[model samples]
Target: MKKQSLVKGAFVLTLAAFITKVLVFSNSIVLSRVLGPEGIGLKKMVMPFMGLMMTLTTIGLPVAISRLVAEADAQGNRGKVKKILVISLVITGSLSIFVVSLSIFSGKYLSSFFLTDPRSYNSFMAMIPIIPIGAVSGVLKGYFRGRQTMNPIAFAQVFEQIVRVCLTYILVQRLVPLGIEYAAAGAVLCSVLGEACSLIFFIVMFKISHHRKMKISRPSWSQAFRGKNVLIELLQTGLPTTGNGFVISITRAVQPIVITKSLALAGVSSALITKQYGMLTGFVMPLLFLPGFINQSLGATLVPAISEANAQNNLRLIKRRLNQAIRVALIVGVPSTLLLYLYAHELMTAVYHAPTAAPLLKLIAPFFLLNYLQSPLQSVLVGMGQAKTAMFNNILARCTNVALIYPLASNPLLGINGVILAISVGVILETILHYSSVVKSIGYALDIPNIIKILVAGIAMGYIGRALFINLNNLTSQGGATLILLTGIVFSIFIYMLLLFFLKVINGSDIVRIPFVGKMLGKIFPK
Candidate 1:
């Protein structure tokens, strides 16, 4: 695919991701009100196990399939693409079943031992079916990604979030009368239904797309057996990637347990500790991740785009893509970090009505811009066949987090703050490592001056916005506070764009690359 097409695909996926995040944010707001901190805490606790299970079952097959299929598609080998998809499905499907069975059988043991609170057992059980359904969906999404057509994957994402939020609200409402535990479990069960819906959408879309391609004769049984090399290639690419994900997943699974236990040891009550955990995970962290949808979409597209370029030894294209990816990351991350830092209190109060999360949001806001950049950098590494490098870096960072969190969280003075510090440090460290790895892989240094200009622009825009907000607050009544904030934010965006233009951070060429409005902007700007 052309570079313009890649950018367009990323744009489409980003828009979808934005909508999805909004739905998810809305879902979290409803859940926060309905479930309270403890119920939300129980629900959050079950997520790590679910993540680990899905990671284990998929075994990085989606990424491997995407990379391999991109290479095949680049070479115009339809048969190879078909073969890769079939083998991936078989491997992932079988592993998913095994994982689900294990999850069902071991739920009691896991919940009893690993979780600090045993009340999460039912939630753990409810999350088991998400594994197989997600596993199937992962491969199908990978197939579409390799094809460089993002609409299906994008639609599935938004559709899944819609279903999840609706189902979770309905289920939690009905189950709340029984108990918060059952309510939390019911909330967790929504993932199973959501994934099932996404899987169906992916299957239908894949069939529709597949039927449009020219027919290729099916390979005979012996020919299929001869394609064992494809399976071997998948394993070779997948194992290291899976190992990286597995390490991260294991650390994540242990994180809540460690933090909660450490806080308990520091003389905090169990109920208070759970509430703190919920506040951090459910409220503050989601706010931190609000800007990540752009990075997520770009990272997803980057894998195939870079893989295809690498396959054809197109060094110039690879470098251009990497540079553009980094620039886009900064453009999004800098403004987001600044806005969150400046408006943490107001945003928390406005969105979740939880004042307690404001300080935590401010504390973590600085490092999260770097966190947003991590996914895209790691995706570049994977695209370059350097998955192990990214994996090792993540493992090192996660190990650091685990090592420091216990001591810090157990400290009487630091307590929960220690956990937050550990997370912030981990995010910063991981991004630095990933960035260094990408630099080494590409043999090109990032444009430091351009990054500095972007940051400066963002800082200036944030300051101006903050000033406007304060002035507006003094003039407006309580009823108009949200409106004032919104106006200030909109003005800040306009100022930021003008700064980008005036500072030469973005030029006519960049503006002209935007999908539909590019031409109009070019005509008006007349570079």
Candidate 2:
């Protein structure tokens, strides 16, 4: 990991994330078409709980490792860095052994008890092997983040996604006729294979680099004598985070169960329940979070950037960075939310061939707009060393959201829509809490005028874009609604860009923050 500036590192990581999402989204489209809603449901039924598995497997050590390593590296203690890594391996490896063993032994009973569908049992079992692959990778990833190295991890993620996409296509096709259960299992196994490949990549990279690419003292094993002290430190630092994450994971895992049971209480049949859940989780979620790449990129860089600023007591720099990140998020995300809302039905029809998801998408888009913007603010908290506060906030939001689901979703009139309403409420609550916390910590100010500017530009773009789509769809008769929708999307985005410059929501300083081409763009796009 070379010492790179925040913009350059974020650029590389964001590009990789973009490619990975494209691949994953494309793969999901293929799988949804092949597996249909119920089949997708079967696969998704086991995925949420995988978060719980991961929280157990890594015990949140990745965060601790990254933080500890960053502190040591700042002190120029290369020997200490290596000792931390060595100790981390011992700890993560031990946890992996125990988690994997326990998973293998209890897979059947656990699946039987938890999953509403028995058909998901095979997929559940198939996914168990990923716990270990994920553990070591998490440690290495944390190490690289601490080192501020983005390329290796970025390259590994895209590579993993590519492999997963290809294997899923081939394997699911071959297995579909056997049964949806087997197909789901095959897809799950494909993910396992992809993760294994990532593990291999990490292992090879670690060995080849030996993490010695920098000027550092020789690797230290003397910590082996005091491994107990290290272990205590690791656990002390990580356990609270692990507990918070475990609660969040459990909250996520329990949601589908709660949603399913509540829907049943609303008198929905089991089959339709599966279909709606599949559509919500598998289809709409992937589409809605499509704009998350921008927020995620900003958040990744925001953390270390703010951390650096805070280290020097540079409150101005921290506030400036926060403003810029939120500005970028709003500029991109508000328009996305508007366009998605305007074209929700067309998008659902075009992407998933399931227009039934249109209402769900439109209903959830506003909430998700807040969701996208919340990332950077949460990162602000983490960067400010208020991670525990942020964790508790998340815990509260999720539990409150879960608590609301049963009451609303059990209503016969609301049904699954009630579940959406519940979570959308959670998003609003979480965003508010995050914003308030950030304000209290740093006196951060929202760019209210610029937000108005984005909304102004986005609303105009959405309306014009929707109008264009309507005209083109009406004019064409050769099944060209999709082509029309794509064209309108392009046209709307062009107009939105022009309006942004006109309204000054974006300016030369923002352009100058671009990774490689900043200076050039800044010259033409002056503030």
| Candidate 1 residue pairs in clash (backbone atoms < 3 Å) | none
Candidate 2: regions farther than 4 A off: 25-51, 75-80, 107-130, 165-193, 203-237, 260-279, 411-416, 473-478, 508-527
Model 1: lowest-lDDT 10 consecutive positions: 214-223
Q: Write the per-residue lDDT of candidate 2 for residues 1-527, one digit (tens) a residue.
A: 46556666777788889899889889899889988898899899888767778888888777666655655666677876776677777766777788878877877777777786778889988998898889889988877766767777888999899899999889998999999899999988989999999989977776677465633233244554566665665665567678777787688779999999999999999999999999999988888888777777777666656655765678998888788778878887888898888889988998899999899999988888898778889878776667777788888889989999999999999998999999999999999999999989998889889889889999998888878878887788788777788999999998898889899877788678666688998999777
Clashing pairs in 2: none
Quote the positional error of residue 63 for candidate 1 in Å: 1.1
TM-score for all predictions? 0.83, 0.82
Please provide, for model 1 over 1-527, each residue's C-alpha lDDT reduced to its tens digit, 9 standing for 90 to 100: 22236667788798888898789889999999999999999999989788778888988888888888888888888888888877777777778778888888888888889887889998998898888788888988887887788888878999999999999878899999999999999999887898899999987786677534633244344544668999887777688888987786678779999999999989999999988999899999887877777888888899988889988889888888877888888898898888888888888888888888888888888978788678778888888778878888999898998888999999999988999999988988898899888777778677788899999899999999889999899887668766776888888888998899889988887767776688888876646
> 510, model 1: CA deviation in Å?
3.7
